[model samples]
Target: MRKALIVGIDYYSHITNLGGCVNDALAVRGVLERNADGTLNFPTPNVLIGTNDTQPVTKTELKSAVRELFVDDSDVALFYFAGHGYLEDTGGYLCTSDSVDGDDGLALSEVMTFANQSSAKNKVIILDSCHGGSAGSNAIARTMTEISDGVTILTASTATQYALETGDGSGVFTRLFVDALNGAAANLVGDITPGSVYAHIDQSLGTWAQRPVFKTNVKKFVSLRKVDPPIALADLQALTTHFPTADHDFLLDPAYEPERSPGQENDPSIPPPDPEKNAIFQVLQKYVRVNLVRPVDAPHMWHAAMGSKSCELTVLGQHYWKLVSEGLI
Candidate 1:
């Protein structure tokens, strides 16, 4: 089970009510629930969201939610908070709606304590709000800061910087964060993790802007989401549309008639097309290597002499086609 405690506070009795915190929380939940490729990475049911717009996220409720999320030994625990954060001598604090003075907030040190005690092998915590950068640090003394092994913490900004948001209810950090998950943060191995996401977002922001903070003890990355293929949806659709069922064999040599085998994805013959080779095959080869298409049926003659020749859409290809044809992606 992958469990998330998503808390977004927009209403406060004494402080200025933020316009974007709730929206920020929803955006994170949406992306984690389903990646841009429409794959269900985190289900809705497993994500527990508490918003001040509907239900108040009191300090008690926040603590309970945070504690409950880490209870399951088999779960991958994720905690995300988007709201007002405060800096005090104790540490960073995640503010709740009921918080009036700076003291009435969830202490960051306490939150980290819960995170450290979690039984989950993979624990991730994300704080998106002002003063979020203060997390995992002691404000008063030059004490050594530390986190338990297997814990990954990503904050919207360094402890001293404010996580900026627009009046339009969008977080600058989160906007880039979501974009990073949608292929921007993908590494050479085609996997995106918290560390990569922080690096991507941090680099994209200007030097004066908030810098995302990432701390990890785990050597191996745990994939929270899978990015879309490098090719754009429109490009993939353009390629798919090139090979209509009724269309003539566009790529294969006219002499290789009966047998059809698409060669190895990188089969020297496949590259960005020029007049020398058919343009359609170039697209097919790119997408095939990315696992969007495959040889549809057994080959007879036209199939690559020994490999494959003509191609068919794989299940993933069909899914992307549906998304593209309908302009969903």
Candidate 2:
């Protein structure tokens, strides 16, 4: 059966400054659950590190967790981490609860070694931490030699910038990463591709000051075997247009819409007597005018629109309405 090991650390005493590691751990789990095929369904991986518990993850705990999670002859193995990452004098160290205590903390090399020791056919390592490298440094270099032929490594940022904490006290990368993973319930089976995960995290954090970087050397076949893309806007628009109230709704409710700015809050863009609902309805109308693709079957529309693997605008169904309503095609 396939197995996954997800760890998030938001409470490292020394690296208490780092954000979202715990939530990141939860998010990674969500990603695996949504991505893993039910035909090959497997038990949840044991979580060894993070803020959900009291004590922090120790080297012994981490090593033990790795050994247990990547048992011999497993079909697939996945490892995810969200925590303080430091490029130390030795190499890259995934700072753990015990890391703050002494030098026994887990090293990137050691983590790689453990994976190499495993019997899994496919392996993926996801790290959302800062890289300790110089300008022009190849963060991929850190794991290239260590990664087996079937292994892939995805990091949160390039070797330069530090991963940031959101105002809510979580890492921006983790927040976006988790949000995307959680969104999978609205997508199709086997639709959670790695490219889609990257897109999810990418768009989720693109506007932020610090964006994460994803690096890989594994052949596309092995690395991307189970990856899927995010739900497309056209798909969401279509769902709303057709069923308008499907159980697995992808559209943001009026309550979830971003509030109007101070300049427009009291005095809405729409004039009086339009009905109070017009405020939100007007915004929704504008969205529908600009975003929906037209004239397609429900399934086809779903695929054409929400099947976006990237952040680009996808056209489906009624391109006519979008143009006329938004004054552009």
Candidate 3:
């Protein structure tokens, strides 16, 4: 089972209210609740958005929710917080609506403790507020941080930086995060992991901008979502079958050129096109489109075929071929 506790506090009585935290929470909930194929990824997330005329998001309330979220033994437990993050001589705190001068809200250390002690197989903590990068760090020591096994932390910015908000009522980090979940961070086989999400966000942001932080202690990454693969599974698996060896080149002739097939402009000078070869050529063309196959001694596949040249697997194609040979695809 997968559970998520998503908190967005936009209404703070003692501090400047934020306009986009609630929106960021709602957007995150949308993506986490469903995968790209419209299948359930996680159960409906426990969402708490602070707004006027409703119960305020106090430190106690947020802490209680987080504790409950991590108390159970489950496959995955995820906690997301978007609000004001206060950092002082002690440590970072996820500010609540009841935050005051000296005290903010729940301490980042406290949150990390809950995650570290969780019974869940995988625990993910995502913070989109300022100083969020301080989540897994030691408050007093500053140099020593202990992240237990299976815990992953992704924060929007470094401890000293501020996460930006767009004029469109969305957090800048979250906008890219939503895009990443929507398949921007997916691998060739469509798996989107927390590490990939961090990479996507990091690359999308300017070097001079706020940097996203990623800390994890897991043996293997868990797929947060899946999208349609760039190439069909069957086609991917056939890489080894077609290449035989990674460096092996597949010879081509005029029969492999669909344009040279019968009923089209006939190249009388060349041999008649074979239907079987043409069918194989179609699959090879698909590989060419994705840069897995490249013509050798010719500029294009068509030229390779017409000139009786050959095509070989690209470096990337060889990698996939190795995976296929090992039955890893």
By TM-score, the best candidate is 3
The better candidate by lDDT, 1 or 3, is 3
Off by over 4 Å in 3: 260-264
lDDT of 1 by residue, 102-203 (tens): 678899888888888878888888888777766666555524556787788898887778888855777888788778767789743346888889888889
Query: Mind sharing the TM-score for model 2?
Result: 0.57
lDDT of each: 0.71, 0.54, 0.89
- Candidate 3 residues 1-329, lDDT tens each? 99999999899988899999999999999998988788999878899999763768999899999999999888999998998999888889999998885256899888989999999999999999998988888877786667999999999999899989978998888999889999899877899999999999999999899999999999999988888878788988888878999999899998888685445466577887799999899989989988899999999999999899999999889888998898877
lDDT of 1 at 270: 33
* TM-score against truth, every candidate: 0.68, 0.57, 0.93
Off by over 4 Å in 2: 13-19, 34-42, 52-54, 101-103, 132-146, 183-190, 220-329
lDDT, candidate 1, at 318: 67
**Runs of candidate 1 exceeding 4 Å displacement:** 45-54, 138-143, 188-190, 231-329
Q: Per-residue lDDT for 223-245 in model 2, tens only?
A: 22233423334533443343322
lDDT at residue 38 of model 3 (Cα atoms): 86
- Of the two candidates 2 and 3, the one with more favorable TM-score, higher being better, is 3
Alpha carbon lDDT of residue 119, candidate 2?
Answer: 74
Query: How many residue pairs clash in each candidate at the backbone level?
Result: 16, 16, 0
State how far residue 265 of model 1 sits from its true place (Å).
Answer: 26
